[model samples]
Target chain A: MEVLAHGLGGRTDLPLDAVAAIVGGGAAVAASFLALTVAWRRPRLRPEGGRPVPARIARALDSPALTWAGRTVALAAAVFVVVVALAGPGGEKANLAPWALYVTFWVGLVPASVLLGPVWRRVNPLRTLHDGLCRITRADPAGRWPIPKRLGYWPAAAWLTGFVWLELVAPHRSDPRLVGVLIIAYGAVNLALARVCGRDWFTRGDGFEAYSNLLARMCPVGRRGDGTLVLRTPLTGLMRVTGEPGLVAAACVLIGSTGFDGITRTTYWRDNVDPGSLSAGTLGLAAAIGVVTVLYLAGMRVSAALTGEAAGELPGRFAATLLPIALGYTVAHYFSFFVLEGQMTFILASDPFGTGLNLLGSTGHRIDYDLAGPTLTAQVQVNAIVLGHIAATIAAHDLALRTQPAHRTVRGQLPIAVVMVALTCAGLFALLSG
Target chain B: MRGVRLRTVVMAVAIGVAVTLAGCGEPAAPSGGTGGSGGTSGTGTAKSAPATFTGPSRKPDVTVVSATVSRGKVEIAQNGVNAQGRVKVRRGATVRITVTTDEADEFHLHGYDRTLKLSPGRPGTLDVVADKTGVFEAELHHSGARVFELQVS
Candidate 1:
């Protein structure tokens, strides 16, 4: 009922076998790049060729009634969780707040966005709350000051770093009372900021919004420039990500924090370098993010040297390629917990306040850990990491050719390919050895 | 014409990786103490991969392990000097863990939800069957200090 101390979900994933899996993952990444060099001679994915979805389906999706309904339901869910978390039973088992936030909402966003394309933007409760406040007060949605030109996505990146730290390193993070206070404080701050910065601020400032939108770049379903719902190659969606300010920072934070999370669970870190205090944990998380940021910049610098491109802009230019890898790391790390804890949340939601009443009647069902056995899970994890690397390599290679002449494309991508292999191997080794 | 060839290359890469994934070991079920040898296997899973799932073995071989809590630190039995935060046991084996604490606390094995109340001098025992394969943390509830994770595979 209390689950584990550091976070939710009592049973953590089994460590991967050390030798074979890491070697396989690294070699697979290397082989994919090498194979791509010989055959994938030029950029192929059509970024402008999204076949428009049928008009009727697009109209249904665009319907204002559906949009309002979605926003209303999402707001209601948020309020319900907040109320129960604040006033409900203290036990995590009886309280649905922490589970809903961590498993059902946060981890669930990955797959949901991958499949449905940034559903959070459509259903964000904060946006609705802000709109309601504005309409009631008859205040202009657009504020007096323009959001600074240099600000770009830096706010989003900072919010993301803050959120990951809370999820991964914050002490007593799983407690419902703490969760309630934090979410309320977080919502209030964001709402206040939105009121000052205007409606468009949420697009580049809210952490969850940016997180979902980043991942949605990998979704096959997307809207064209004209707002028509269109179906495109998933890679094309990824290829279209522009190198906006803080784009690299956001990507690095995502990949690095995930990498840090994998490292924390390893036996080597726990036994050898166990940081005793919260300050130590905060430092470790920062160090992990810093390591990833430096490695990525170094890779881009080398890419510039080889391609004869300007060194200053290469990191931003290639930042879009990291999205697939980030998604892969996310899936590899959180999917199993999502499946197991998601069911637990469903059952707990049936009794939001630990009252005897089972609202959804799901409390009668049991949480089945057998949904994924160890062997099956390990294979999936390994495959997810390896597949992510291959996709990244493909994206990088395509972008290289598209950005410049084909003559130096393969050579320019070689350094990045090496970097990808190193990241993939380090990730696998850390996960397995732990 | 080029698109078809490029797709072929991607397919080849995917198939090659799938083969590698298949070669990766299952970590458990193989070379584990499934033969009822009663601790003879002793973590020697370095041998050939049988790739076979052995049937249900003899009675749950209960391993008696203990931990002592003092000076606000937990010292697990036989896992000192280089503790990996857990004791490894093959799935299907039963473990009977005993703990003595300087503080009044309750021993909780999560996932299994097995709990035992502990007094300052009096020890408590939690008997668990490692039927599920994963790492479950065991902790002292009141102090919230971990008493070694149970790594069942």
Candidate 2:
């Protein structure tokens, strides 16, 4: 009668040698900033510069049939999960729906987007459903009303927060019926919004879509103005990101959620924070997000003042630089879960309804817990967090060079660089301590 | 050019230092439990009292056994009265855990892969030799409630 816990469970990492890892990470960031200030004079990450993919390949990727196929596969998977969630046994071991959503989809999106670009946009079932309905009705895919410009990505940010709360804090997160209901509610709400707002709803309104798109900015494979596939530097793609409203909130939600995930696993959190009460968990999640947002805002304000830019506009302007940091935390926190539980997804898929049907021939699969030992896991976590901060520091420095005068560039970036170091240290500490 | 070269050298030195520091901070290897601490030190330490068997049978050393459940909440005795954070024991120690619940449920100890069926008012016992050194989860299978973390140093 042994069963896996609701969340990914294993030996948590031993507490990091905090003094060494944090100080080292901080020093590296500071040194990089100083070197960049002196040695790097020009802005190198220009968005318009990229080598286009060969014409044949680009055309094949752009084909409407390919897009439809992707949408179909995504829709079919969603429908399967929904069916199983409704009828499958309530236990986590007996259900494939939770594994598919949490491990395969949520954690899998990081590497998938990084390698293949924004796959979710092409494969989002709700968007496909909306488009199909529109075609059937003889209406334009773009809805009657345009989404308000001021609304921007705020709804997506709110939705992202709500999703994290459900995944990390909700008592019934592993309950199949609850998950199924939430999925249906999420899809229905987004589909209705898309009806009024058109295709733009998926880009700036859907939480998962926005999350995928943001991470995709770090992907080297992108499209040009003519929809031709191109190979570009990740930095170039990141630089092209526009300062959209609510971008800061969205980024903070990502950073904060991952931070809280790490903290919730620690002995301190487990012992002090009552497991039965949702209040402590909710407050902790909010506090983590708040701290990240406040620190980011402070850095932006300082940089803005130094560069003679508008303080009010700094948050959105600097938001894209934090994407790498978010990506780093994500990779560090979810790497093991993705590796271990991701295998379980295949096993569960074989008998999704718990009727013992071995459809995929994966029923014999066994999860190898020793695939990643504690030492290796700790090393990877530290490296990811540190490397991500380094990437963010470089991006911020380059952005400062682009925005400020030659004399002011270094001054403007100093505060932001320090903030990046602090954030890196914080991320490292959380991983190690947790 | 001089400033560029100087900055390059400095950056290289800083990176070297960072890498060196990281390498120096490799975590200590998991060791046999011996230290006495009332609470978990976030690492290996036997924090529980030596077990006392009431029966005529003299068995191996039992660190801590028996946990009570009421209204879906689990309570284990640390010093001997109330349940708390974790039950820490030395490696190779024989640990027998008995769980009594208000409802019939499956009790599972993760990592060790031990399971028991607990009937209402009847205590179910799971005996295991703590040969492995790590923290394993003790949980109620049906309710998915974690009873406590078992740390075997």
Candidate 3:
């Protein structure tokens, strides 16, 4: 049981009981079937109209002054973090860099994007740095060559995989020096690439940006097709997720790795597998992610055969629906950790340099574990999984209305339905089983 | 709407399944009620305010497991040999983790962050109340040797 505490391996929520997991998976499947049967035949979620905010309000929110100020603040924070990471105290306890990256930025990005809609893009320090350098050199911020259309989100998927590997498989992942080096390296590579690839590089290239943008698609607040800022149901935002190339890979990477993380938490995994073995970790991660991809592709193939749609197109066609499932897995796996250790992010932020000087007087409290009870945590986990399944089903059903012929819609969705159910069960079982 | 009717049907079937399955095992709801003084333990109540820890009146039900570390090798034995696995128990059970190390090491229980300092040729005991639920690792913090995991549900 030599399970090295994964970075921020603080507190894990208690596993769900068999009954809850079963009931959840059962209810999820049942509701999804019912939804598919009763859902509207026509494509209901149009990309056009939502409750549009006033133009003046939208302008104020997206104003240059606000953007510049936010970017400047973000740049300053980035500079401060780099300084602390390079020069501050070394240990996990004293150093603030690891917590800032893993806890605040990595884990915190989920809720932030879900709530605030692509908040990172607005405040990405790397983007700001590129813009500043470009301005200083009197160069165009958008670089010379436009990013190729065929390369949709593939780089994002690759970089996201790299990051997931770093988080879950890489040795010394918790080391402050490693974190600093990673940050610097990631920045330098992306900044240099951004210089040549134009501003669209970050949209489809920067892994963090892609992840933020992916999650933000489910946010209620977003711009419509005409660039009108509108408030709508979160599911409607999900409807807007295009089945572009590599979208499936990105979603699979997110959810599959989360499932792998869940597996690592299990006593069975810890006992049988070498906990600290990098090869084992990498193999398990790849296998988990591969299982998801294989299942999805297989489901799509079945659905395509039944519906007479191209198999290649179906994976992309239905990729948007996976977002909810991805969100579900994320919420189930990391919700407790974020709620509990997320406190450390803010606390450490106050004394960023490992110095006694507290910029914000917020380091007075410790992580309140009892804030999230085991029962509530279990409920959230199961409910999130169930709800995510339901949402994905509905989205698939609706998208099916658009993609598949009217006669073939139900038949085509049957396979995807099974896929959703299987994925949901796999997720629930991962939560419950040791 | 057909959806409305299906929803009702689904709920009824779910209830039926739940009732049928309840006979097989304990209800999957939170059932641990061994709260010492935290009186809000009817169903894992939201513990916000710091309650005074009044140690229980009844004798603590203790589950003891011991480990021996010698020359970078760990041998965990509960009662016999080669039985090192997750020590699982219901919430509120007391677990006394005993460890004897050939070298100086500190056993750190994660999640609870409880620590027990151990020296050579001396066995150290750390008593932990399984108040919180989760899988927590007991590791030699310095050596990063994870001895065992405690699973409290």
For model 1, the superposed segments whose C-alpha errors exceed 4 Å read A1-6, A274-276, A364-366, B1-58, B78-84
- Which residue pairs in model 2 clash with each other? B76-B83
Q: Model 2 off-target regions past 4 Å?
A: A1-15, B1-106, B110-113, B119-123, B127-136, B141-145, B151-153
Q: Native-contact recovery for every candidate?
A: 0.29, 0.09, 0.23
What's the lDDT for residue A29 in model 2?
77
For model 3, the docking class works out as: incorrect
Higher-TM-score candidate of 1 and 3 = 1
Question: lDDT per prediction?
Answer: 0.75, 0.73, 0.74
Best by DockQ: 1
Native contacts kept (model 1): 0.29
- DockQ of predictions, in order shown: 0.18, 0.09, 0.15
Q: Give the alpha carbon lDDT tens digit for every residue of A349-424 in model 2.
A: 8778777787867653444444445565566677678777877887878877777778888888888987998898
Scored on chain A only, each candidate's TM-score is 0.96, 0.95, 0.95
Each prediction's TM-score versus the true structure: 0.88, 0.82, 0.87
In the range A1-434, model 1's lDDT, one tens digit per residue, is: 23242268677888878788889889989998988889888778777778899999889988999989999899999999999899999967668788888877887787777767888898899999888899999987885566886787788899989888888788777888988998899889888888888877888888888889888877778877677788877777767534678888999898888887777777766666543357767887899889888999999898899889889888877887888788778777876676666666667777677767767676534455666678766866787788877888888888887886678888888889989999999878765565
Give the worst 10-residue stretch by lDDT in candidate 2 chain A: A1-10
How far off is residue A210 in model 2, in Å? 1.0
